[model samples]
Every structure is written in structure tokens, then in C-alpha cells.
Target: MTPTPADKPPSQALFSTIAARYDRCNHLFSLGIDRYWRKQLAQTLVLKADDAVLDICCGTGDMALSVLIHTPVHCVWGIDCSETMIQLAQEKRIRRAGRGRLRGKTLRLSVQDAAALAFEPGMFAAVTCAFGLRNIPDRARVLAAVFRVLAPGGQVGICEFSLPRFGLLRSVYWAYLSRVMPMAGRVVIGDAEPLRYLARSIDHWHKTVRLEEELAGAGFVDCHCRLLTGGIVTLTVARKPGPLAAQPFL
Candidate 1:
């Protein structure tokens, strides 16, 4: 139980160590409901052809693939902090191309930190992060980064695990997230540490209202959330307003 400077586990090292088994453990921990969650997120964004989308913390590119499958988006870029995860994503890209699933167009995956995005302003039409925000300690910085890279009126969609809103559901969710998830990680991934971090991070996450307020404060407008599966997870969507010229102060 080592702590980092940010009062969280060293996510970079932890994710690097567990990159190979990350997806497997996700399936086990969520009882495979993660797929449905990702689908809902992709659907909410309403991606279109010729649209540019950025998937931050895009481990193994599942959400990106979901976009490709559901939307006729011209380009999809997936980025993560872990190089190993990027490698796997690239390998999958290659396989997808070989199978004639993706041709002519390019699918890109790279190692990039969300808090310091390496892109020009308004580069993407939409942005997404799935099950990744909690791992980031400086949430506000990342949200600011998201705002900077997004074009005015670009949409942002985020899906994350949350404690259930109902009492009975919260108890069941906690037991599965805390105890069963770690055990499944040990049995399936052969690494229990990352799962422990995943659980602890969610347990200590800022409340939903606080997060919504933070997004609004960071320049996201029309922010709204839909709690899924009895609030075990929440998907929030917001749009960056058109260029903010000087306005009279109240």
C-alpha cells in the first residue's frame, strides 16, 4: 500500500505493470457491463463522418473502436500514458486493417498524458475518456486540457464508475468493487495491486455534483449526466461554447 505525492497510487507505474491484463480484469470486475457503458458513451456523442475525435486515456482503444463501429468518423486517435497499452492498441489497429475492417483511413494510438495534451486548440470535434479520470490526480488540469484542445461547440463525453445512488445498490456495488474486483484481478490478471488502486480511487472520488460543477467551472456548458444501471456508473456530456469574447462582468 504505497502512496504517491498525489495521495493516490503511482498510476503510471501501476498501469504500466498491469497493461497486458487491464482489459481482462475490466471484463471480470464489471461482469462485462463495461462494454454496454462504452457503447452508451459513444452513442451519446453522435459522431459523424469527417469528424475528429480524441480518446484520452484510451487503454487498448476499445472506446475508439466503438466509435469506428457506431459512427462513420473519418479519424480516431487514441492516447494513453502507458506505452505498453499504446503498443497493444497499435497491434489491434494492424489486425483491424488486415481484416479489411479499416482501410485507407488511419487509426492512431500514442502515449500522451491527459493533463498536458500535445495538440492545437480546437483539434477535435469530440473528446472522450472511459474509466480513466479517477486515475488522474490533477483532475482540474486535465479538464482544462480537454477544453483547450476541443473546438468551440465540440462535445465531451465521459463514462466512469460511481458509487450507486441507492443504499442497497451502493452496498452491492461496493462489495463487488472492493472485494470481488481485487480477487478477480488476482485470479485473472495475476496482479492485485492495480485493482486495489482502481477500487480506492473510486471510493475516494469527488462527489458527482462536485465533478459536474468542476466541469462547468472549466468552461463546459450544458453539462448533464445520465446515471446508468442504477447509478453504478455515470455518463456526463457537455459542449464547449463558441469563442468567448469579452463579456460585461455582473
Candidate 2:
């Protein structure tokens, strides 16, 4: 646990309140596409057998688990500011541990803020965040923090929702958000406020180009953004310059 969160921010705290049902709601709303987005995001990591990974705002460890299963990484650390979320992660981690799915790789959990990590400089080989950046207000700070802990040559994969912009899809998406989504959330989770925030965040979030610029400004080189599922979701991958990049470009 590195410089962990003593106080949960309001948005994260709201996540805590819904932690028990959060995963279910997400899967339902995304029609299970969230799983595919997470898989694609996890595939962006530059993992080595001896490399360690950090998943900030890991929520329920979905992406972190993906990293573990998708690559032969040395270990994984999944952190979040919401205790309830972390608690759920712990349970899942324990179950996976007993099932041998961990493959002898370490998976640690911490209740830490994404903007303020506890690990030392260049402590991780890679870092990834999925669907969590939209909830974070200080995304720049979190990016900087990710840059700090990631080793040179390490990569960061960020998967986030963006508002739809295409013609008919945009209209249908907005209508779903305004009407069907809230009704689904309320019916399934007894709350629609969180879903509302999720929609609003996407509506106001930085578009792909702006997000890439922000990542580059934070010292992440080789930044790239890929749109998925009709541009409603974006997967951004950036590399931290390191020994390989400096070795006299062949």
C-alpha cells in the first residue's frame, strides 16, 4: 500500500456505495462489450516474463486479471480509492489464487488514489486504467503519477468511454442514455445517478486527439489512440521513453 487513500473522494465514494452491483450494471449496460474493451486494453501492455504491472483505479480487477491471464507478467498490483471496490477485488483475487489461474504470479490490492501512487519511481513495467479515468477529475495528475511509477519503456493503456458522434448512432446513444439507461440502472441497481454521471463524463471528456496531446504533455512518448465500437470507446496507449528508444535508432 503506497501513500494510500485516507479519505475517499466523493465520486469514488459513490462507486463504493454501488460496488456490490457495479460490475453487474456495467456488463448489463454495455451488453457485455465492456469485457471485450477490457481485453483489448489489456492487450496493449508491453509485458515481459519478469515485468510487473500496476492497474490504477482497478475497480474490480477485471483489467488487472486480464493482464495476468493475457500475459506472462511477473506480477500485478491493482489499486483503487474505493474500499468497497477493493474489498470485492480482494475476494476475487483470493478465489483466483486458489484456482491456479494466478499461475504463481503475484496479484496485490491497495486502496490508493490514481493521482497519488505510493510506489517508487519506475517501479512498474506497465500501467493500465479502464473505464475509470472518466470518474477522475484530475486526469492529468493521474497520468503524471502513472508516468512516475512506470519504468522507462513501460506502456500505459487507458480505455475510456467517449460520447458518440456518428449520425444515427449518436441519436440512438443519447436517447438510450436519457431514457433507457436510467430506467435500467434504477431497475437493476436501485440507482440511476451513477449511470447519469458516467454518461455526463463521457459527454464532457476530452476527445481522442486532445487526450493524446495531454498524454504526450505528461511525458508519455509514442502516444496512440484507437477508437472502438463505433467511436464510443477509446483505447489510448503511450510508451515511456527508455533505454530501447535511446539506443541509436536502428
List, in order, the clash count of every candidate structure. Answer: 0, 1
lDDT at 138, model 2: 76
Return model 2's CA RMSD, one decimal.
Answer: 6.0
Off by over 4 Å in 1: 1-9, 98-105, 206-209, 243-250
Residues 28-83, candidate 2, lDDT per residue (tens digit)?
Answer: 88999998888787766656778888999899889899888877775889999989
Stretches off by above 4 angstroms in model 2 are: 1-10, 98-101, 206-209, 245-250
lDDT of 2: 0.79
lDDT of 1 by residue, 111-205 (tens): 99999999999999889999888777688999999999988888889998788878998888888877887787788878676777777777767
Q: Evaluate residue 152 in candidate 1 and report its C-alpha lDDT on the 0 to 100 scale.
A: 86
Least accurate stretch of 10 residues (summed lDDT) in model 2? Answer: 1-10
